[model samples]
Target: MSSFKPSMSEPKSPGSYCGVPAQRSSQWGPEMVLVKLEDCSHPLELNVIVKEEEEERGIKEEEEEERAFTEEQRAVTEEAEQRAFTEEQRAVTEEAKERAFTEEQRTFKEEAEERAFTEEQRAFTEEQRAFTEEQRAVTEEQRAFKEEAEERAFTAEQRAFTEEQRAFTEEAEERAFTEEQRAFTEEQRAFTEEAEERAFTEEAEERAFTEEQRAVTEEAEERAFTAEQRAFTEEQRAVTEEAEERAFTAEQRAFTEEQRAFTEEAEERAFSEEQRAFTEEQIAFTEEQRAFTEEAEERAFTAEQRAFIEEAEERAFTEEQRAFTEEQRAVTEEAEERAFTEEQRAFTEEAEERAFTEEQRAFTEEQRAFTEEAEERAFTEEQRAFTEEQRAFTEEQRAFTEEAEERAFTEEQRAVTEEAEERAFTAEQRAFTEEQRAFTEEAEERAFTEEQRAFTEEQRAFTEEAEERAFTAEQRAFTEEQRAFTAEL
Candidate 1:
């Protein structure tokens, strides 16, 4: 018989395992390369068949021996000793025959029991053999399965090791490529670092410039605010000063008015007292003249002539006193009217008041004519009256004192007094006009200065605002430039 053998170095091929005819007709797939047997027959049936064959052979041998023995015995003893033996056996009897038959039966029963026991032992042995063969086959199958599992595990391990080696080779190639580019990368990194440093420096400078611009703008704004505040304070001070000045001017005007009123009242009282004293002197003079006239009439028998002279002189003196009073009253009224007009002109914007001017001029002319007429009449009447009285009553009026003549108001003295008063009033009015003009000019100047200051402040504010806006725009543009530069880098 040919046996299948497998090699350890190489793998097996696809094939079949089968037994020869009359030996074992076993079949198996390609994987079962080892030799194997088929299942055995039932041992009980084989035991029954063996027992029958053994019994047949024993019977046949027993029959052949009995036949041979019967032939021989007949040839040798059938003619000689049969009668005497037969007579003796016959005399031996039936009890000995019975003992011999019992012995044979016991022997056959023992032999049959022994044969059954042997057959049972053989069946038990055959069953034990079959069980052992089945056990061996199972053990072999388990071993094969274990070996196949081991082969698969080894194959997986080899694949894993091969992948690890390939990965190591690829890493080595990558390291070589990286080494080749190291110089260029190092130079590029250095250049980038330098560029970053320069950009940082430029950005810092731009930031500082922006900060400086901001600081300057803030300083300018602060200065502008301070200047504006100062201007405001100055304006307030000027307004306050102007108010105080106006109050002072009003007080001065009130005081001047009060002084003028007092002066006018005193002058009027003095003038009235002077006129009364003059009238009393004239009366006394008249009484003296009448006494003188009566004496002449009594001494020389002069009758109606002396009486007529005394009455005529008295009438003339009375008329002269009345005219003087009238003239004084007219002068006082004219002066008062002129003073009122001048005051009104000072306090009003009446430069074009032509009617008032014309009226005042006409009134001044009328008063002047009246004053001249009164003065002429009074001078003429005084001269005439004085000449007649001195001539007619020279002897009697020789007692009149020279002091009275000196006390009398002549036309030249009155004219000189009026001229002095007029001059004083004109001078005072001129001073007031000059003062008013100065005050008005100063107020106008202050207003103009305030307007100019306001314009200057507005211009300065506009300039500062524009400067700040320009600086902010420049800062934004510079920042954009820096950002663009950084992006390029």
Candidate 2:
């Protein structure tokens, strides 16, 4: 029998085998077998006959025995592999358990250390509290001691001030007494000198009065002499008047003779013998008038001598009488002067005694006034000193109080500053905590973004590989179709 092989490039219809067209026939069963035949005279006759059932049954029995052997070998290999995987899994689980136990031990050690640190901080705080209490006690004791010392000092100063004030008052009183004594002595000396001057003036006035009385006596005597001289002068004036009348009568006679002579001479010029007679008559008249004047002068001189003798006699009489009167008046005046002298002596004695008594009284009054004024001055000085001391004490107390207030203010300010510093520290710690939280959140966001980007890149690479494989499969299908079409052509 001969076999035929189909060509790779043979064109076949759909659902056909080896270039043969398939048909449905009753003579060919569903299990039809393909046969190869040589060329023959009759188109349907076969040269070889074969039993299909017996050959197919032998081939099926051999294939079943080989498949059973292969299944047994595969089962042995699977069992071995499963045993190795179970052993490796047990080792990995044991390593993981050891690492978990180590982490738990380390956490417990950290917790123990934190507890120890907390206990040490609590002990330190307690020690600080005890120390603060001790310091406060010491400060309170110092304040009490200082106050007691200040009180002692103030008392000592007050005692010393009192003693000083007493000394000053005693000194002032002594000085005032000395001044009053000096003033009294000066007043007494001035009064004594004034009394002496007044006594001298009185003596001088008495001497002047005596001299005036003597002058009055002399004036009375001179007036009596003057009256007698006036009577003698009146008698001399009467004698002189009688002499003048006689001389006037003689001069009238001489003038009549001279007139007759002059008339005869005028007639004689007419007659020569009458002219010689007229010359003789003129000479005779002149001689007669000269004799009459001489006689009158002699009678007047005799009358003047007679009047002087009588007047002198009267004056002598008057002088004797005036002297006698003057002598009598002098005796009377002497008696009056003695009596006046006695009265003046009595008046001077009385005035001197009254003046002395008045001066003494005035001195006593002045001394009393001085004593009163001194006492008042002393009292005023004492009041002023007391007021000054009180003011000084008040000022010292005010200064001390101000100092204490300043110290208290300084302490309060220190406490306030410490509190502010603590607040600043707490704020700094809060800011640090917020910054740490922000950093942690930003790191987690960055990790998430990086993971998403990696996943997207892996997905893109897988999609590109799938598309390339599909394109290669389509190209292979196209090449096979082209070969078949060429063979058919």
Off by over 4 Å in 1: 1-253, 279-420, 423-489
- Tens digits of per-residue lDDT for model 1 on 147-253? 45434533443343234234333575446435533753575467457645744664565356446534743653464345346445544643454355455676685
Per-residue lDDT of 173-245 in model 2, one digit per residue for the tens? 4465356436644754564465346335434543443344235324322432342243234334323433443
In angstroms, give how far residue 211 of model 1 lies from its true place.
Answer: 99
What is the clash tally of candidate 1? Answer: 0
**Model 2 residue 355 distance off true place after TM-score fit, in angstroms:** 17
lDDT of each: 0.47, 0.45
Best by lDDT: 1
Q: What TM-score, to 2 decimals, does candidate 1 have? A: 0.22
Model 1, position 158: C-alpha lDDT score: 34
- Candidate 2 wrong stretches, greater than 4 Å: 1-400, 403-407, 410-414, 462-489
Clashing residue pairs in candidate 1 (N, C-alpha, C atoms within 3 angstroms): none
